[model samples]
Target chain A: MTAAGFPIVRAPAASATDVRIDPALVRRWLVTFLREEMIVRRGMRTAVVGVSGGVDSALVAFLCAEALGPANVYGVRMPYRTSAEESFRHAGLVQEITKIHDVVVDITAAVDGYLRYEPDASPTRRGNVMARQRMIVLFDLSAKYGGLPVGTGNKSERLLGYFTWHADDSPPINPLGDLFKTQVWQLARHVGVPREIVEKPATADLIRGQTDEEDLGITYERADRILSLMLRGYGQAAIAACGFRRRDVRLVWDRVNATHWKRHLPTTAVVSPTAINEFYLRPVDY
Target chain B: MRGAKSRPQPSSLLGLVPRRTSLDATGPSVELAVVQCAPRKGDVAANLRRIEEAFAALRHDRSPFPDVVIFPEASLSGYFVEGATVEVARRAETVVDELARSARRACGRKVGPFDVVVGFYEEQDGQYYNSALYASLGRRPVLRHVHRKLFLPTYGIFDEERFVSRGTSIEAFDVPYGRAAILICEDACHSLAVTIAALRGAQVLYVPSASPGRGMEDVEPANVRLWRDVLRVAAAEHGIFVVYAGLVGFEGGKGMSGASRVIGPFGDLRAEAPFEGATILRVRIDLGDVRVARAALPALGDLEANLGQLSSMLARTSGQSVPAVGARAARRR
Candidate 1:
């Protein structure tokens, strides 16, 4: 029961796994948020999105086109030399469907330029360099094209810290930040995203044969269920008791706790009486 | 010859017809539902789509469906929208007609020759009203009642007066189940509106509101407690059921109070929805409960008898000449 004495009925476990969302409600919410937070509040007329041919970025592009017309939306596809041909093809599909202005930036030179500094850089370092390089291109185009860069990170990836920090997570505004990966897939289907892109294996497309589940060691379906339980205030023991493997539960819990710092602004040592983000606080709009 | 007189013994005896002991107990009961929804600010089309979805969900239930479904204040266009021009205000009749058609089509023969009451900003004759429409849905649709907001609250975060016109009168009208009346958000705060409704023979009083919840930690939001007290007292005092359907959402930094509920005529809490989410609360009520409560305490009868005297006193207090009893009665009729 809630504090107000109303019974708290949890969504059925099966339903939670399949997460029913009212697409119209979500569409209206995103449209209103963009109108208020971007155009009306921040005085921005155009939006720039980095479309990677995955469900998350595809969903973001569709939402931006819906909120601001296709003429005002700019889709940037940044591909490295080793990037999959399917990635470029799906990105083109998004551009065709949304009819938004599109640009292709080849980042192989920039990435290889940095890789020359350390020939033995690990795969993780190389992936990070690619992610950061793509962001650099997106941000630069945003400035040159006079648009604000919008993010495409979903909640599951964010909670699991699957993306490179300060690279994919640095966009000024994001419409997909709160939707889970599974929910994003549902919304993608509802908003007319191509079936091929929605059904493809989730990946960052940095390596030749990398899948998100293989890298994270947990399928998105299981990860989303566990994350939903944790969000509803279930403790580690309680979640395991609900028929989940204890190891997986602990893994998700540890990841969420470890990545807490990535969700907040940098900590500043307080020197004066009222320091930034301490006593001298201001609202986001302010 | 002497008497002639028993003045033709009175044709009929006074008070011979037995006073109705429990009219509500004899009549059919009604299943009522209140939908506490989070409306998208200034998005009428989306909000209407959501309301239709709720009705569709109710249609699938095998149990007895609600005879009347109530949505929160401004459920069509949202509340606190002072920035919306008159162009955004919807015509109440057109919206209600469309909703009735949809409801009939969705429910089919499974349910609802029922009525739906929803709030919206009503536009008519170059003026706008914060209004609630009582629409009846069957094979065809009928506009039963339209209650504009009587009290336009303008304190603190409320700027209703700046956006819409105030309603002119308070009266109860007949519905399929029984007599009922409607009061918009701030109107529920005024006791006189409830009294007038009950005095005018309302068995059910519907208070649809968009009151924002405000309070500190560990304490109930003030509007929740206030509306509860109002509904309870009005129900118990006048023996009329009270339904409060409050909107739930954060609009421009203001969070609405979402504790929509139904109070029985005896002041019993029937059902209450949550304070933060979108929910449909259902409760079955016998209009006979009103008769049961009224029988226990004959307040309505007493008030009806004393109204003429009160009117006279009011006239005197306001320094106006009192009309002849016949003329006053004629005017009332």
Candidate 2:
């Protein structure tokens, strides 16, 4: 579908050889456009996505650019003092590639400023404070621009117990909520993200030296492979059969199984015969 | 060789013919009548009269007055009444005085006897809700329950989130003939609603919908079919009976698909109504059948256990339960 009827702006694939859109990818892209129209037609103005210098954000930025236009899309890159120079460089690379306007706000001052007032916060708590500071900034910007803050967290983050709720993660809109990390990479390449940025190690960059895979103690390639099997209703034996160690399989299972609540809305016990959310979400409109 | 034994077996035909085995007490079978109709837009008076007329005809003809009559979502006001304030108020009728008068008049003027489950817009505690009123003749009509929609879908010609607040509750309650449950249109798609109803021991699930039927320009017929099938799966999984009622005819330029149907505990369609005009379907449902099916399959038992796990997981993630040192550090907001 062309731009006349569709709102998708597919970037030139990584190379001329890979120009064709896979049938599955095309189907998903159409669904994405439909979803965006659903959001925009409801009167939302713009979208703000956290640019984490990772494949997830890159794909999200591209999709946002396609759905809402480059002018209607904004990116916020919050890098701490220890943040990799590549974080700033790649974010700029994506902005130049996509031509979406962005704000490079440094949150070190804000994070340190707040921490000085509250001394007893733990390392995890402090890390969360940094994550939430970025969100607060994004939301403030969202309100200013009358936009929705789009989430960049992929399915891997959601499945592997990687996200911090209401802090490092959680957004008003999640475009890539259903895609895995591997799929994120595939989309990033298809959307023409620079190889330098796409190949870089994934990280929350909460602390200067931290990387996500290091913190989770597993590589994304292995993690995604394990998760794919798990999602298919496979057990530990199948995971082990796929070359994942028993402990690694157990860890992935626990992460997904234990953090199940992150995937759903709050639960309400049945009290009346006609309970909303108990049987279904009743549409208030006719 | 079998002549001697065959002669003795011939003495009792019960020993030869395959018998219909019934597990529980078989009571005197009573005809249960149900009216499924496609209501017009803001034509509350007309819809009420139509229902009255249908019931009156049923009684006079001795066709059997429906024991229970269910209408579609916001059937009185029709679904898409545009203005926020006027539309909300127009649809929201409490029905204490209005429905009582209608019931008495309906019995005398139209139907000789009947009970009703009518969908309407209602305002309570200064909050507007998509509500339903259950009325019975010769008795104070029970309000039954009102459910505000939970997921306000803003996708594809839908802007419900703009006008309605999300409901925070999921429940089921008892009605006269059996333990009955009700769910609105979109509620029929979500598993949580059906699971909760089954957990509460509801024997029959009633869904009244104003689903956009075929040729709405924007809406598809497939979505309607999907919702209908999902109802069956939910009913079978929960070991409960489901009665689906939908509104037909065009309202606010959008068509309402009126493929209303009823499914047994095993996901078999017991009855169905056409997509046009008002209809009254009477089918006898034995609660004992539900008991027999549930006893044989015992699926609801696992649903209960799964629900417990779901709750604990929710409590754990929300940090609603106070945690120790490690847990406190992870507590967000």
CAPRI docking class of candidate 2 = incorrect
In terms of docking quality, model 1 is incorrect
Cα error, candidate 2, residue B141 (Å): 3.2
lDDT of 1 at A243: 80
User: Could you give candidate 2's per-residue lDDT for residues B1-333 as a string of tens digits?
Assistant: 000011111111112111233224252233455555655455577766766665555666545566676667776666665444244453323564566566666565454434566766666666666665555654555556555656556666665655555666656666666676777778768887777667766778777777764321122355555765797677677777787777765543344666677666666556666544456665656666676556656777765545555666767888777423332222121
Among residues 3 or more apart in sequence or in different chains, the pairs in candidate 1 whose N, CA or C atoms overlap within 3 Å are: B24-B288, B25-B288
Lowest lDDT 10-mer window, candidate 1 chain B? B1-10
lDDT of model number 1: 0.79
Instruction: Identify the candidate with maximal TM-score.
Output: 1
How high is each candidate's TM-score? 0.52, 0.46
Count clashing residue pairs per candidate. Answer: 2, 18
Interface RMSD of 1: 12.2
Model 1, span A1-286: residue lDDT tens: 8889999888755543344466755665566566555775567878888888888888888988988899999998888898999999899899999999888888999999989998899988999999998889889988898889989999899999898889999997777777788878878998899999999999999888999999988888888889988987889888887788998998899999999888877878899987865655433333
- Model 1 TM-score? 0.52
For each model, chain A TM-score?
0.92, 0.82
